[model samples]
Target: MSSSRVRKEVDEALYAFVDRQRPGLLGISEDLSPMLSALDVLLAGGKRLRPAFCYWGWRALGGADGPEIIAAAASLELLQASALIHDDVMDGSDTRRGQPSVHRRFEALHASEGWPGSAVPFGMGAAILLGDLTLAWSGEMFDTSGLPGEVLAPGRPLYDVMRTEVMCGQYLDMLEQARGTGDVESALRVVKYKSAKYTIERPLHLGAAMAGASAADLEALSDYGLPLGAAFQLRDDVLGVFGDPAETGKPAGDDLREGKRTVLIALAQERATPAQREVLRRRLGDPGLDLSGVEELRTILVETGALSGCESMIDEFAAQAHVALAAAPIAAEAVAALTDLTVAATARRV
Candidate 1:
């Protein structure tokens, strides 16, 4: 199926699944209505890349196109939503997709109600519960996706591993930030588990496993997916530093403010001069960072060759992904769709 069609089907599946939960939630208490509202907003904005990867992975292994598979793939969106909502809370971000982040939205709601001892705590608590709810629901969605138990059983290990890897990756990310080491190796490690596997590799594995793919076929998919996933995240790091706010949805240099120890930043830290390093230490992670500070950091990233180095890495990884894709023993149509996705995932625009 085409990407657009996949998106539409996934969206339909997701909405239908979430709608089924509404009556139960409202029955418990109407106060839980905002939980659904928050999910609706969060679910609307992603690229739906994970589901696409999952669907195409199944197709590559000769699984037929059907609502069952689409519903199974759509479950990844809830997983993605769970990650993103919690990530925003962890980063203390104020906005997402050009709107208030879930925590901030709840915080605002608390403030508007004038019935809270402290709005921040209420917001944080609500957001955390919502995130937990989505995390649990992701599993529920996948299990009840209408795929036969026999088909679904084989993929369960992969699904469970993917979840474990992402959470560990998230912890590693937090550890990196806390360490503030700016080491390229450590940063790349974070990229692998937190993003590369979760974003691409394991999703492919889950789908392929469901289709009863051979071990060789699974290896081939990994060869293609791992490099592409890395490149995808490197591109994201670049965009975080220099992308237009209109395109990225967050303010310019939001990553810098978040103190993300991205490979790009690590590279800059390695190459920077004494004064430049000092400037980086001072400006980066300052939540009140202004446009001028952002510009300064951008200049530092550029002059230190970190930006160019990151771009080179992106090109190299993408090339490796293409070469692997060429050798992958999969359907021709899957190859074409995955090729298009590689571009979409790593494109300059968000």
Candidate 2:
């Protein structure tokens, strides 16, 4: 079956597991209702991209369907959801997917029921702790997957590396925000450290290793995944400015509002005229900047050909990823699926 079809099956299974698991949460003793409610919100909506990537990696490494592998993959998806919830809180985001962000929701919950503590920080800290719990739960799920003891062992180290990589990526992102991430080289390095590897490459490696792929095969997958992940993030950079709120699930131009120094922004500065560059330098990090200014800046981006240039770069990375896949010694079917996923992920509406 195609990956989409496979995803449908897995989606149904995951939700069912989550539903069953929900009741047993926090045990019968204390009032775990709030935590469970928060968890439900976390799991309520998502693209499940991480698990799908893991699944594809396994498929590439010649894995066949079994309950244990599916459960392990599902655990990864849940962990991603947990991460996003905490990430949103850390960013102090007001909205997510066009709805209240995790901290906001928690704060509102606290207010509505008259719970104590400073709502903002309390909510954020709680969400962070909850996210930690989710990661822990994922580890537990993997341990209980019932796979042959041997099949699970080799994958553990790779899985451990993935967690560390994402945390490091988050830390790098925080650093970039604090003190500007410098030139094109530095910008690209941030892209690689903050997103490319952990989001796609390492997860692919983890899943493939789980299926017992050889070293050569794993290296080939990384070549494909690294570039594809970079392209995926580049597309996200474009969308954060140009995409519609209805589709992208964000207030338009959020990165600009946040003063995020993306590759696109860097490229725009590099190409802009002196007057245009001054406009950017003045308003790039100004939190009070308005939508009209954002639109005008976007206009400058178009006039200077920065948007098109960034688009070309995104295409280049995606193309390289495809080329790497073609050179890899994987089954034709798995390659096709990964190709489809690559396009879907980068050029996606959401």
Candidate 3:
């Protein structure tokens, strides 16, 4: 299958899950509407990336995507939705996909309705609870995924490791922002922990487990997935700087404003002249910077070769991933699908 075809199939699977899944959780006076709304928000707008990765990984290892596999994939997506919600809160991001984030939307509603108390905190609190629900339900979905319980029991340990890595990665990300990047190695550490294991490795493992894919196949996926996931985040780091606000739906220079210690930034700091470094140091994290300033910084990044340097790294990781995929016990069609997906996904125009 082609990447576009894979995307369509994944969308169908996800929507089928959503169509029958409860739109509202039931409980007397339990505010089921809000919880349902949160769930809808999660399911409504998505690229279905993680779920598709899981599904495809299973398919690649010669297993069919049965109900158990599909449900487990959806559960992984729920986990991603949960992470994203909390991430937006932590980043204080206002927009997602060209619209207000859930908290901001809720806060706007509270203001329009003249609701009592501080609507900002109230909305954030609600979003937090929703995120929590998503997280818990994700685990529940995993438990009830209908795969042979024995096969799945071993996989939970991998999922648990993934979760711990993400939390630790998130914490490390915050610390880097606060404490400043001491060196390139420190920044890469953040990328490995924050984006690699959870985003790709665990999803691959989950899929393989659900399908009863062999241990050798599972190892092959890890080899492919780990590098590919790291590459994914690296591409994202590039886009954070160079992407059009219109296309990315993130404000231009959002990562700069956040002072995220991305590999891109590390390269710039290492390669740029003192004056260029000074400009980055001064303006990189300033949220109040205007468009022209952002553009100027973009120029500096290009001139410093950081942009191209990051692109090279993405290519390297992706190439390594392809090598691993070629070595796996997957069908040619599935390998082609994954290959196409990786190329299109990693080389996304900013």
The residue-by-residue lDDT of candidate 2 on 80-198, one tens digit each, is 86677777876677777677776787788778888677777777877787787777878877777677788888889988888887788777777767776445566777788667876
TM-score of each: 0.99, 0.92, 0.91
lDDT of 1 by residue, 1-350 (tens): 89899999999999999999999999999999999999899887888999999999999999999999999999999999989889999999999888889999998899898974889988898989999999999899999999999999988999999999999999999999999997999999999999999999999988988998989999999999999999999999999888988878899989999989999999999999999999999999999999999999999999999999999999999989999999999999999999999988887663
Indicate the residue-level lDDT of 98 in model 3: 66
Q: Note the Cα lDDT for every prediction shown.
A: 0.93, 0.78, 0.78
lDDT of 3 by residue, 35-95 (tens): 5765676567666677777778777767764667666676777788788888888888887
lDDT of 1 at 225: 95
Model 3 alpha-carbon miss at residue 22, Å: 4.5
Global Cα RMSD, each model:
0.9, 2.1, 2.3
**TM value for model 2:** 0.92
Report the lDDT of model 3 for residue 185. 81
The whole-model C-alpha lDDT of candidate 3 against the native structure comes to: 0.78
Q: Give model 1's TM-score versus the native structure.
A: 0.99
